[model samples]
Target: MSPHSPARRRTAIGALAGTALVIPFLAAAPAQAAPCHLSGSTGSCNGTVHQPGSPGEGGGSGGNSGGGSGPVAPPAPVGLNPNQGQGFVQVPGNQAPPPPAKPATADLVAQAQAAAAFPVPIVHTAPKGKTFVRLRTSLWVDGFHVVKTQPITVGAQTVQLTGEPATVTWDLGEATRTCDNAGSEDGKACSYTYQRSSAGQPGGAYQITATIRWNVTWSCEGADCDEAGGDLGQQPMQSEATPLVVGEIQTTTGQ
Candidate 1:
């Protein structure tokens, strides 16, 4: 007892060192967590496993054993129009095209008549507005002779110069030259030097237009000048109108 001193203390220290060394070997190992496994298509976890007294404990509680639950959400509603959808639904927007343009009025019949009566035999056809015929003659006449065969224009009716005599003015293109008579029979004709205002048409064709206006006493032989024809009318005096055409290119000199 004098000194359980130095040696005893040394021995105690050695023993402590030895115990520290052996402690790790004697302790239980940590429990390992299993990797998650994807199971049946349903994808719901079934169960889990755990170590009873292992050094590493409580880890098994949160371990993934292929039986762990997977993320889940509610299913969408059934039976809706396919076009109608969640995020964004494309739409063809409603729209109207521009209104169709209006067509132009065609005066085909009138144009045909104009062309046909281009340079001869003035025909007074009833027109909607102010229809007229211009006659270009070699002789210039101040007066005009108007006779209604079947009442060509203004319908089939008799019109007379009664009461106050109507003063009919004659208009010959630019100037009206006085003449003895004007018509097919003895009507004054255009001046001898009369030539087409414009040039003749191509391909030996001549297009000349002349106009004359006059005031004549209205009367009919059997029927009044008013009552006349509809589609066609016979020549009252000589020809209601006169149009002369030369050859395609030749002049009176050649013909």
Candidate 2:
């Protein structure tokens, strides 16, 4: 019949099927795998993986990892004892503060002055004679004792201040003299013999004044130290003025 017949087509199809089966058998196959190894906090295939300990890992009681819920906070620090600490002792909130600092020296001095720490100057001897004669004199405190150790409280501090005469300064109306450590005794060492009559001076007499210097010191219950303004050293304490009459001695020998 025709060149292309049914028999011829069936023969061609049979040959194609046989060729496809042989080609699949000729293709290459996959290679074999190497062994997998693991170490502490690390793993490796052909490459490796590593994890290290974080800083302050063992400082406190807490987990190192931050994976669970959230991070674990470290323990609280321990407090120190105030009485046993090495450096500066810590003051407790409940502890009472030290007694207020001692009052200033100037304050103590003012208190003493207010209390009349030094007694009024007393003239032991009065001058009664003509010019050229040595004026016999003495000066002293009437009470001649401490200021009774008066206690003066300022702010929160209390200081006891005691005072007494340390020196005496004399104003002879015409001249002045300062005697140290001279209290309650004959003042002959500091005496002055007037050379002229009182007619030249007011009231026809010399007006004499004695000033006593008070030496003050202060202290607290626990310390013997002086207050800041205490120890005013030598403070001038004055006395009322006294009049002395000096007349010229008459010499009616050879008229």
Candidate 3:
């Protein structure tokens, strides 16, 4: 019959079959691989798998254990409500306000009229000196002249106060000549002669008032100073004074 006994052959086959069955069961028994999980972009057996937990399925506990991201803020708004606390705005240099207007012609004319309506009153003025006196009063007179001389007496005189006093004496500077009007019924031509020292600077005003000791021989006619008349009385002769101003000195209107 069979070269080897039947029992031995049967035993060998039984051992091979048992080994195959055991190996398959061990391979199928849920491997000890890492727990199923999502690791970054890759899946891993040992890592946890994220999922929306089924209703009441441990209520999501231990399900998706991922950390949530922080809230993202919106950009700032623009337009009317925009932030203006940043920079300054520039303006053109020539954009200044206009200047005020000048006075009108009518206004100027009115001002001139007002000024002309009321003028300043004229005043008396004179210069002071020794051996000589000047008439500075604004009194009305008949004839006047500026007189000067080398040997003028400064002291008091017979006809008036002497010295450089404010008022002039009757017998001022030396008498040059005396003449009388003759043969006239009206007796109007009598005049006394006196001399001035200097013409002074032109434009200046001057006057001479002197009381003389004249003995007219006789009363005469129009402007005739005849020495042949009767003895005449010595009287005071005042001159019509001329106004003098700064311009009179140099004929220029000084400031």
| CA lDDT of each prediction against the hidden true structure | 0.33, 0.57, 0.32
TM-score of each: 0.21, 0.46, 0.18
Clash statistics: count for each candidate: 38, 4, 42
The digit string of per-residue lDDT tens for model 2 on 1-255 reads 455999888878999998888777555222114323334444443454423343323323332343212345776556856456477585668677688665665565566557754567665444332333344444433543456456766555556666776677778766777766454455545555565667788878777777876777665542433433335465566878777666666568786
Off by over 4 Å in 1: 1-32, 41-46, 49-96, 103-182, 185-210, 213-255
lDDT of 2: 0.57
lDDT of 1 by residue, 39-108 (tens): 5332212354333322223254342233444444667668654658575455556456686642211222
Best candidate, TM-score-wise? 2
lDDT of 3 by residue, 1-255 (tens): 464989889988999999999999889667644234444534433353334454322354443443212234777775433435656433447476786554333333233323321111121222322112232212212222222112211122111111111222231223322322111112233322223333463433233333222221222222222221232222233333333322212246769
TM-score of 1: 0.21
**Backbone clash pairs in model 3 (N, Cα, C under 3 Å; residues 3+ apart or in different chains), count:** 42
Better of 2 and 3 by lDDT: 2
